[model samples]
Target: MAGYGRSDEEWGQLTSVGLAFLVERARLEKTTTYTELDATLRRRTGLRGFDFDQDSERAAMGHLLGLIVERNRPTTNLLISALVQYLNTNDAGPGFYALAVELGMLPRRSSATAKQAFWIGQLNALYAFYSAGRRGA
Candidate 1:
């Protein structure tokens, strides 16, 4: 939970932007890369978004995504971050799985396949929740 120089209000705004973008993407049954999300955040917030190449910034994005998860956990109980993936590899970062384990959504001692299963489950749930009734409407 490092602040990374972002104030509470800033975090709130950034998280709001990210959540809205992700929800919309989910409704379209689409996935976005970290760089794409960062660009969207910068354009929407008028702030210098994370470089994403830097480790610190990557961690910051993870933290921001974690906040998104925490914000919607009560209603959805799903990792919305599952819709986000690394650009080089079409997979969520380790932090995504870490957050799942931290929240007890994924078992701590799970195998790689088990972890992937959990991520896929969350993603399918997200797609179902948002994509339902969104098409041809």
Candidate 2:
């Protein structure tokens, strides 16, 4: 779709139906917490719950990826770490905040536009790198 972190065939790799439902459900329920979204995903997909208590951000992301297995959602901590590396390499953004909320690291309903701006800035910077990577060897 017309948004950040989107691709022409984003639908190409994602478990379209499942991820769509999960994203929609999270939005509908006003559920900003990662745990809530995970629970919803598990319930909908009949999958196991993530172990956030263990500081497993990677595992948490994997659970989401596992649910959205059709697309490249990322399946390990390495992906999350890579994303973090990319983010800090420049700055962060709304997408990053959404990710933080989805990971239960940050909550939804942010009042701090400054924080959102910071996150958005970070995202734009990373996008530039990824875009460049796509055009090169």
Candidate 3:
């Protein structure tokens, strides 16, 4: 299978490390003030303000990751639209997506297919990494 030029073992190592970092970052972001998070999301998604609570925003982050793995356009678009309408979202612009790129979920932005391939590769690697862990356990 195509990977980020890494062997299965290497990919697993990267995924484990990257996922740990992302989750911890999520937890930290949860602790920030709502006003601060709102401003950050505004800068990220170009939305005006946030109206949802911390819990909802946290849930949305998980939901976003799931959607990324699913790689369904309609569902992804629906999620994005809902977030825009409600002003509840994740720090994906500078957070999860960035990690995704580093983990080889996406090609560099200059690549022609970077946008399309990003989510697909990420989902593939995510499932691969977790499945490997489960088997080991």
| Candidate whose TM-score is highest | 1
Which candidate should be chosen as best, given lDDT against the real structure?
A: 1
TM-score of each: 0.91, 0.34, 0.26
Clashing pairs in 2: 13-70, 13-71, 14-70, 14-71, 91-122, 92-119, 92-120, 92-122, 93-119, 93-120
lDDT of each prediction vs. the true structure?
0.84, 0.41, 0.36
Poorest stretch of ten by lDDT in candidate 1: 128-137
By lDDT, rank the candidates, best first.
1, 2, 3
- Candidate that beats the other on lDDT, 1 or 2, i.e. the better one: 1
Candidate 2 C-alpha lDDT tens digits along 1-137: 31223343432223453445433432232213454545555676554555556646434444344435224234211112112222123433234555556765455766686555645553443344334234211
The reply for model 3, stretches above 4 Å from the true place, is: 1-94, 100-108, 132-137
Model 1 has an lDDT value of: 0.84
Q: Which window of ten consecutive residues has the lowest lDDT sum in model 3?
A: 77-86
